[model samples]
Target: MFIQFLKENRYVSMLLTLLRFYLGWQWLTAGWGKISSGKFDASGFMYGAVKNMSGEHPAVQPWWGNFLKEVALPYVDFFNVIVPWGEFLVGLGLILGIFTSFSILMGLTMNFAYMFSGTTSTNPLMVLLGMFILVAGINAGKIGLDRWTIPFLRRLLFKKTEKEQFPQSA
Candidate 1:
């Protein structure tokens, strides 16, 4: 039934596009603020975060945490420096619509981390937003740089694919 609605309403596509762009812009702006504030600090913070998260969820702790603890934490400064930049890049990617799907997934990954860390309330909005972005797929690129960049991006990322054209609905 919902599928029929999705098929019938052309505005559903527009809603999805607007939602993705707005959410992406919001995320990018927030992350950019953090980066520009010059107070970015994730050293022991992220390590502690990752450890606490793993300890809290014993059943789901990936083996990679051990590697993160051993190899990654040793260079805490590097992680601290990069985390905000990574956030900014992912946010920029989404906001700019460069890699809409991948950026949405990255945003979801970060949101999931926050959600799992006993911060579900604040994360819910973004999490739902991520879900919508994912369900909407690549059709959410009309009002962003992705519309112009995706052609070049497709050549670089999906050079062998013939299905990299823009959506008909747009």
Candidate 2:
């Protein structure tokens, strides 16, 4: 019910777009700063994430801790490139609405990743906004590039081919 309303309503969608833009801007600036500074390495952060793991009310999950210890920590160089570029791309997608839903999904995934690493900060709020945007569906992107790109991509990917597959008698 509420989802339907959010999806179908123009004003609601506009509001959602604003939120989307905000998230996009956030990602863009963060990534751009990293790229420009040439010092946005994730190695130190990853090390700290592992070191921060504690008892009882631990911030980081043990499973994530294991992954960090086993995979991420050993591959700081790889993560350094991936993180900044990933943030930049996500921000571009969200801002342009070229792949709005997919962009939001990616953002949500990153939020989860950050949270799992024990860094809360704005992740919770971003996740909430991302969820709402996801719930709003195409409406969230009706005002942006997705409005055209999505339909075009859909037709390109799923066009009816029965007529082309078989000759119909006139």
- Taking all chains together, each candidate's TM-score versus the true structure is 0.66, 0.92
Q: lDDT per prediction?
A: 0.66, 0.87
**In model 1, where do residues sit more than 4 Å from their true spots?**
1-9, 47-68, 152-170
Pairs clashing within candidate 1: none
| Candidate 1 accuracy as TM-score | 0.66
Model 2 spans with C-alpha error above 4 angstroms:
162-170
Q: What lDDT tens digits, residue by residue, belong to model 1 across residues 1-98?
A: 66454434567767866777677676777678878998866555546545654554542245545655666678867866666676777778776667
| Residue 151 accuracy (lDDT) in model 2 | 93
Per-model tally of clashing residue pairs: 0, 0
lDDT of 2 by residue, 1-170 (tens): 89899899999978988998999998888888998899987877777777767788878877888898999888888888888888888899888877888888988988998988878899999999989888888988898999999899899998878888787989
Candidate with top TM-score is 2
